[model samples]
Target: MERIITVRAEINLFDGSRSGKTTGYKSGIRPNHFFEGQTSSIAGDIQFEGQDELALGGKCFAIVRFLYPEWFPPVVPGITWRLHEGLRHVGDGRVLEVHSGR
Candidate 1:
């Protein structure tokens, strides 16, 4: 069975101040910024351990993990940074397709 999971990338903005404040616009709240060029695709396998009906029907839950790049451009306040986008198969197994919400 094959499954495609689409995901949108977001950056969490936090204030560097010791007072634990969030940096954003006048609202003091930062919204999730979805960009057109900041998306990744990861492929992996889904293994079921039991005979549950949902598992058999390919409806079982899965958790996929991946590593982000060690180097990224410097972040600027009030600006969302999106570097790359598209689908690239990094491995072979079940397929998980991630798409960026622009």
Candidate 2:
């Protein structure tokens, strides 16, 4: 079975221009093992709930892919995952919240 998890992530797109270009590093959510050979990005709107207090770059609805049932690990609510920087996992704000996609 295929499972797609939706997460409300606080993504920090490096220090660069937001001019409709894919610039800067996406500092959040290490891609699940299922999306090994495929390219993906979190697409969602910018949330401003706690912008001032947190000073986060922006918030968005990131789609986390778990192509198979076994691909997903036991997750705890409100636990943040580090972002992928090339082969390394760095940074923070990759909060995951699983939804029932039945």
Candidate 3:
């Protein structure tokens, strides 16, 4: 069986000039994951640490759980990615740790 993949990542939400989200993101929100140099995105859920919401243009560490773990490339520390709502880029992230998940 394929083990669910999860990671600890450092996320940065972009501001309006970058065509990012107008507001902010809350924990447990599912967003598409676009790995570096990749045009397409994989499905995932991000839960921010501590705060209930991460404001636009804010940076924080989050736990990311990939919904379809098989669709992604090998995740490792220092590899970067982006978070999207549909095709719109909203945030950026860098993998800090990878582990098995439920």
Candidate with the greatest lDDT versus the true structure: 3
Most accurate candidate by TM-score: 3
Clashes of each: 0, 0, 0
Best-to-worst order by lDDT is 3, 2, 1
Q: Compose the digit string of candidate 1's lDDT tens values, residues 1-102.
A: 223332322222222242133322221112222222455432322222232222111222222222223232222223333211132111112213333211
Q: Superposing every Cα of model 3 onto the true structure, what RMSD results?
A: 2.4
What are the C-alpha RMSDs, in order, of all predicted structures? 17.3, 8.0, 2.4
Write model 3 residue lDDT over 1-102, tens digit each, in one string. Answer: 244578999999898778545788889888888888666777788888898899888999988887645545677789998788887988889989987652
Model 3, position 10: C-alpha lDDT score: 95
TM-score of model number 2? 0.38
List, residue by residue over 1-102, the lDDT tens digit for candidate 2: 545544454444322242232433342324323122334433222232333222224344444443334334543456555444454433344555655342
Name model 1 segments beyond 4 Å from true. Answer: 1-38, 52-58, 62-102
Q: Which whole-number lDDT from 0 to 100 does residue 78 have in model 2?
A: 62
Cα TM-score per model: 0.19, 0.38, 0.85
Q: In candidate 2, how many clashes are counted?
A: 0
